[model samples]
Each structure stands twice: as C-alpha cells, then as structure tokens.
Target chain A: MKVITIVLQIGFLYVFYITGSLLQRLFHLPIPGSIIGLFLLFIVLLLKVFPATWIETGSAFLLDYLSLLFVPATTGVMNYFDLFAGHTIWLFIITMISTLIVMIFSGHTSRLLARYREKRREGTECQQSLSESSL
Target chain B: MSTVLIGIVFISLTVFIYLFMTRLYHRFYIPFLIPALTSTVAVVFLLIIMEVSYDTYMIGGQWIDALLGPAIVALAYPLYNQRHLLLKNLYPILGGVVVGSLTGIFSGLLLAQSLGFNEKLLFSLLPKSVTTPVAMQIADGVGGLPALSVLFVMTAGFTGVVVGPYILYWFRLDSPLAKGMAFGSASHAIGTAKAIEYGDYTTSVSSVAMTLSAIACSVFGSLVVLVFYA
Candidate 1:
C-alpha cells in the first residue's frame, strides 16, 4: 500500500508535468506548466473525482518539501554577485528599506480593516444599548 | 566511465547538504530556505572559484532542480484537501491575490521609477516581488534577465519571511486562514511555508491560496505584463 500510495502520488505529478507542456503548446500561456496541472486537480476535486485520502497524502508530501524545489533558483542567485557589487550599498539599501515598507503596509492595511470592522461592530452594540435604555 | 562514480558521490553530497541544512534550520530557528540557499551558494561559489563550470555544478544541482515540476503538482493536493474552507473564503482569496500581486508589482515598479532607475532595470524590478519561478518567467518573457528575476525572487522570499507576519498581525488578521492565504498569494511557496507555521488553519488556507495564485498568475500576471508591452 505504501508503494502504491507513492506511485499514485508520483503519477499525479506526471499529470502536472504533461499539463505544463500542454498549456505551453496550446495557449502559449506565460504560466508554467505545473500550475496548469494544479488547476486541473482543483477542478477535478471540486467535482469530487477522488477521495480525501488521495488528496491529503499527496498534498502534504509536496507542500512539506516545496522549499527544496527552489534549490536551483536559490543557488542561481550567486550569478548576480556582479549586480550586487555594482550597487552594493544602493541595492542593499533599496531592497532592505523597501521590504520593510511592504511588510509594514500590508500588515497594517489588513489590521486596519479588521479594526475598522471591530469599531463598526462596537458602534452597533452602543446603538443597541441606547435603544434599550430609551425603552 | 568515472562520471557514474562522480554522480554517486555527488548525490550523497547533496543529501548531506540537505541534512546539514535541515539540522541548522532546526537548531537556530532560522528559516529553512536560508540554509538551503546559503549552502548551495557557498558550495557552488567555491566550485566556481575553483574553476568548476556551471554545468558541473548543475550536474549535481539538476538532480535537485528536477523535483520542482513534481513539487508544483503537489501544491494542488493541498488545495484539494482544503476545498471546503476555500469555498467559504474564495472571494477574499482572489481579491487578496489580485490586490496583493498588483499592489506589489505596482509599488515595486513605481518606487524604482520614482528613484530614477533606468528602463531595463525598471522592467526587471517590476516582477521582483512575485514568487521565483513566476517572477523569473515574467522577467525572461519581457526580455529581462531571468537571473535578475531569480535574485528578485530570493530577495522577496527573504523579505517575506522577515516582514510578512508582522504585517499580517499588525493588520489584526488574527484569522489564521486570512493571514496564511495573504502571505501565500503574495509571496508564493516560501511565504506559504511561513504562513503554515503561523497556525494550522492559516497554513491550510494559505497552501490553497499559494497554489491557486500560481494559476492566477499565469492568467492575470501575463495580462498585466502584456499591458506594459502594448
């Protein structure tokens, strides 16, 4: 069953592999092929073509090791040593500062929306209290 | 003849590297990618400085890189598993991705433009905030260097890890699902992992969002780029 499970999981990966090539050839889509495969799986599941276990094991294995997939790209960063050296101070300054800005803004924006919702909720409660007191 | 022996030696070495990275990550509370990336860079750079060609490095590395295709396929399983929860928050998920992606691209581009960066660098900088593969593809398609996109991606991932949660928490997005999905959609796989760490509820939703956004990117991200070209 273990081998069978692994085989099924790997088989699913093959489906995605083929989808990648398909999207490339047919649509000339700028998207990667694997992403198309993912969409196919989404559609299939939404339609209930498979059981939950089929979904669970395969998904867990992939997501758990997803970081490992970027090994090549991560190493590929080294090729940019010259780019970094060119504006070491400037690029570092820009990247570092900008990343913090992105972080702070996105965090606060989401938090603000949540807070605004809470304030609105509190306002309704206060109004309800006043109406009850009037009675 | 000796290539096979070297190949075996290389495989074991890569495993050792992975194991070493895993241990370092566990012990130090650093993110996993940092070690994986740093070690790969350190090892590869040593090889390069020692006069080894990229092809030789790739000989070992490709074994690792080959898994990327399969890993992407794995993204969907999470989506499938989280179907019920996703159906509940589908609108927010899509809204967050579109808003987050466009805002990220726009801000990065505008910031560079305001700073008076040249056109080529500006074009390269536009997609820096997206995930690596998608970002790299966008960069390459528009005649920017794929390499720069990769750098942008790593930098983005590093930034996401450092600053993503603070923003999520700051916004009081205490709903683990919302926090995770936002990070996953905006930041991609690396961000998704961090999202998962935030909580199970968020991790599950974020995993779903991360996978979908990649699909969304192919559909939407291209259109955005096309507008620039047209």
Candidate 2:
C-alpha cells in the first residue's frame, strides 16, 4: 500500500515534468524542462493548490537517492577520455581555484550582509524601546 | 545478453555499487570517499576492464538516466519547505547566489581562456558550479560537451566538500546563512550534504542556495554565452 502511494506520487511529479517539457517546446524557452517543472511545483506548493503530503514520501525517496541517479551520466565521461587526457591537471586546477573563489566570495558576502542586517535590526529595536520608555 | 537482461543487470549493478559505496562512506566519513565519485569510478573501470562499450552499458544505464529529470523536479519539495527561511533572508541569499554564480562563470571562463582552452571546453566550464542535470543542459545549449561538463561539476563539488569548510573558517564566516550559501552556490548538492553538519537551519539555507544558484546560472549563463560565442 505504501509502495503504491510512493509510486503514484512519483508519477504525479513526472506529470509536472512532462508539462514543463511541453511548455518549453511550445514557447521555445531556453531553460530546461525539468527546471520549469521544479518552478511549477514550487508555485503549486506556495499557492496551496495541493497538500504537501501528497508528494512528500516520493520526493523524499527520490532526493535520498539523488546522487545515485547521477551515476550513469557521470560514467558517460568514459566516452570522452581523449578530450580530458592532456587537460587533467589544468582542469583540476581551474575547478579547484574557481571553487575556492566562489566559496570565499559568497561566504564573506553573505556574512557581511547578514551582519549588516542584524545590526540594523538591533538599532531599530533599541530606538523603539527608547521611544516607548519616553512615552 | 538480451537487451532486457542487460538493462536489468546494469541497473542492479549500479545500485549495488552505490549502496556499497554509501556504506563505505558512512564508515569512513571521508570527504573524498563520496559515494557518487567512488561508485562512478568503480563502474567506469568495471566497464573498461570488461571491454564493455559505453553503448552496451547504456542499454541499462539509460533506464537509470531517465529518472534524472523526475529527480530534478523532486528538488522542489525541499525548496518549498525552505520557503519561509528563504523569504526571510531574501537579500543575503539572493545577493550571495547572484554574485557567486557570476564569479563561477567569469572566473572559470577567464582562467580556462587564459590557459588556452578551446571554445567547447570554455562553455563546458561555464556551468560547472550549477547542479549536474542543469549544468548538462546548459552545456548542451552552449555547444559544449555535456559529458565533460559533468566531470567539471563533479570536480567542483568534490573541491567544495573537501576545502570549503576550511575557507569558511579562515574567513570567520560563523553564520549558518553564510556557510549554507557558500556550500550550495559553490558546490550544489554535494556541498549541501556537507552543510548538514552545521544543523537543520544551515541545511535548509544550503538547499535554497543550491536551487537559486541553478536558476541564476541557467538564466545568466546563456547571456554570457551570447556575449562570447555569438
């Protein structure tokens, strides 16, 4: 019974994916269909069009094994050995350096922005309390 | 082997290897021993040793690959769950992901070009920071090799899981929001997994970051391609 529910829920999600693909083709969208499906589902959830429980179990199951699903595609690298042969070290360097740059830049940027927000909130709270006491 | 049997065998083999790798990862808890990386290497080498052509392997592999689209849609659940937190911290999260996505694209293109890589390789490197499925799509759209883009995405993911924490600590980015945004924007799903160590709030923030970064890159990435390749 539980297995059937999960299967049905997954089927429901697949419907969204198909619809997204159709929309992409009809409209000539540059974005991937799966992404459009994701956005549609997100909008549906946000609008309370359906209860979250309907797809909860199935989405959880799929997300848990998400990395596993990537295996076949990742393994496709086997077919592209020639392109990667001379560039292995350079590829690693570029990915590593870029990864570091992104991590640092985003991390610090958010942290500073968050701190700025926090300080502003505190300042407003302090002003409110002072005004209330004066009143 | 018959086509039906080959499909079943390959699917089972991939699943079994993934399960075994997961167990090994949990036992050792090493960053580099991630199941995705290990199982992929294992399966690839197995195919090479058995002299099995990729086409033959895909007889089953394609079945598994077909699920990737649906799985991507499943990402919406987490995004939904994190909506409250995402809305509350909209500025920081949005600001961080946008900047990060641009940095990923520009830095990757500049470095790769300076190193004298060809146009195809540059396009492949452009979407390396986004999650694999979307990155593959963007790469295909931009005249890059989708398969090679996966390699770059995996490398970025691995690099983040391994080195991201140290960078965060060195920079004293103690806020959960900062930590989550860093991992998700830089590394996608793999980085989100690492963010789990910081607790649930960080995990939620990281997942949101991952999704937003994907959306940002997909939109901005094409514009970057138009500027360069067009």
Candidate 3:
C-alpha cells in the first residue's frame, strides 16, 4: 500500500515535470523546467485542483534527502579546481562581502518599512484619542 | 571492478563520509565544520591523493546530480504550506527579496568585473544569492558554468550562515520578518537553517522569501543575462 501510494505521488510530480518541459520548449523560456514544474504544482495546489495529500508524502520524502542529491554536483567543483588557484582569495572576499551587503540592505529595508507602518498606525491612534478627549 | 561499480562505490563512500561528518559537526557545533564544505574538501583531497579522475568520480556523482531537478520541484510543497503567510506579508517580502537579490547580483558582478575576473566567472557569480538548484539553472541560462556556480552558491551559503546573525545584530534589526528575509535572500537554504534557530515564524518567513527570490530570479534574472550576453 505504501509503495503504491509513493508511486502515485511520483507520477503526479512527473506529470508536472513534463508540463514544465513542454511549456519551456513551446515558449523558449529561460527558466529551468523543474522550476516551471514547481510553479505548476504550486498553482494546482493553490486552486485545490489536486489535493495536497496526493503529492505531500513523495515530496516530503524527496526533500528530506535533498541535501544528499547535491553531493555529486558539489563534488563537481573539482573540475574547475584550477580556476580557483589565482582567484580563491578574491572569490572568498567577493562572496562574503556581497552576501553581507545583501543581508544588510534587505534587513534594513524591511525593518524600515515595518517601522514606518507602525508609526503611521500610532499616529492615527493618537489622533483618534485626541479627538475623543476633545469631545 | 567495472567503472559503473566503481562509481557506485564512490557514491556510497561519499554519502557515508557526509553523514559521519554531519554528526561530528552537530556534536561539536562549529560553523567552519559544515558537513558539505568539509566533506567536499576531504573528498577532493582524497581524490587528488589517490589519483582518481573527476570523471571517474562523476560516474556515480551524475546519478545524484540528476535528482537535483526533482528535489528542486519538490520545494513547492513547503512553499505551498506557507502560502497564506506569504500572501499576508507579500509587500515587505517582495520588497526585501527584489532589493536583496538585485543587490547580491550587482555587488558580485561589479566587484568581480572591477577585479578583472573573466565574463564566465561573472556569469557564474551572478546567482550566488540563490539556492543551489536555482543557482545552477540561472548560471547555465546566463551562459555560465553551472558547476562553477555551485561552488559560488556554496560559498555564499557558508558565508551567509556564518556571518548573517552577526550582521543582523550589528544593524539592530530584530523583526522576525526582516531577519528571515535577510537570510533567505542572501544565503538560501543554509541561511534558512540559521533562521530556523530563531522560531517557526522566522523559518516560514524565510521559506517564503527564498521561494520568492527564486521565482523573481527565474523571471527577471534572464533579463540581466540578456543585457550582458545579448
């Protein structure tokens, strides 16, 4: 029973994958087919076209082992080991600095916006209180 | 043994080493001891010392690599689970991700270009802010070496996970939403792991931010590529 259910879940995912690939080929999309497939799955789930239970188990199982799948590609970096020789320090510095910059700017912007909304609400509340007191 | 058998052996060996190292990392609780980074480094060294060709290693490695697509597609489940939170906080989430992703790309490209890195390297570095699967796709779409982009994304992930908390505290940004966006936008999944340390709210928000950034990149990242390569 478990095995059959898992197979059905995989079948559902494969359908989305095929849909994504077909769309990409027809439209010449720059995005990866798998991501397009993800969007398809997301939309279907959003609209209740497919019950989440249909794919949840299989997706959870796959995602659970997701990091394992990356090992091969992570090891593929060896092919470019020579590229790292001259640029290792530079690459490290650039990635570190850029990530830091991203964190700072994104966090700062979100916080600033949050603070602004809070202040506006507070201002409106103050005005309401003042008018009630005057009355 | 046949090459195919050898490849399978290598895969098992790598998985064993990775799992072992992860347990060690958890026991010790050291940032630099990340299982992925440490295992990659160790395996690379082992291969070099043993005179095993990378192609030989990849015989098994490619099998694992192929799963990246499905694994990435499965991300939709988690994203779907958090859909309501995403919609509720859509404005700030979108605002932070768009700005952060653009900031990541521009900063990496300009810095590399100024330092005289080749165009290929520039393309590889462009998607450093995203998760590995999405990063690889964006890199390949933009004519970069997908393998090289993996390296860059891992570095970005490591750096973001390590330095992200300090940066957040340094800037005095305490909101869960802000913290989550910062990690998800800058580092992707590994950073999201760091965000999870805070609470469920931060984790869900980080997941939404990471998902948003991937969609934004897939849609607009190509435009950045077209501007350069076209």
User: Top model by TM-score, which number?
Assistant: 2
DockQ of 3: 0.56
Model 2: residues with Cα > 4 Å off, grouped in runs: B118-120, B140-147, B169-174, B189-203, B222-230
CA lDDT for candidate 3:
0.78
Measured with C-alpha atoms, the lDDT of residue B208 in candidate 2 is 76
Off by over 4 Å in 3: A1-11, A118-135, B116-124, B131-147, B172-176, B189-204, B215-230
Question: For model 3, what share of native contacts is present?
Answer: 0.69
lDDT, candidate 2, B111-229, per-residue tens: 98998988988898888998887898889988888878888898898789877777888888788888899899999877876676676678767877887898899888999999877
Worst 10 residues of 2 chain B by lDDT: B192-201
The candidate with the higher DockQ, 1 or 3, is 3
lDDT of 3 by residue, A1-135 (tens): 887887678667877877887897899775557768888888988999978998888877666555566667667677777867765569768988999999899887777776777788899999999999999
TM-score (second chain) of model 2: 0.83
State the C-alpha lDDT per candidate: 0.63, 0.85, 0.78
Per-prediction TM-score, chain B alone: 0.81, 0.83, 0.78
**Tens-digit lDDT string for candidate 2 (A34-133):** 8788889989999999999988998888777877887897788788778656765696689889998998888888887778898999999999999999
In terms of lDDT, the best-performing candidate is 2
- Checking candidate 3 for backbone clashes, the offending pairs are none
- What tens digits encode model 1's per-residue C-alpha lDDT throughout A89-125? 3544455445445444443344455456668889999
Tens digits of per-residue lDDT, candidate 1, B14-124, equal 667766876777687654345546557566766677776556666667776776776766666656666676676555555555555556666666676677776566566
TM-score of 1: 0.81
- The predictions' CA RMSDs to the true structure, in order, are 4.0, 2.5, 3.5
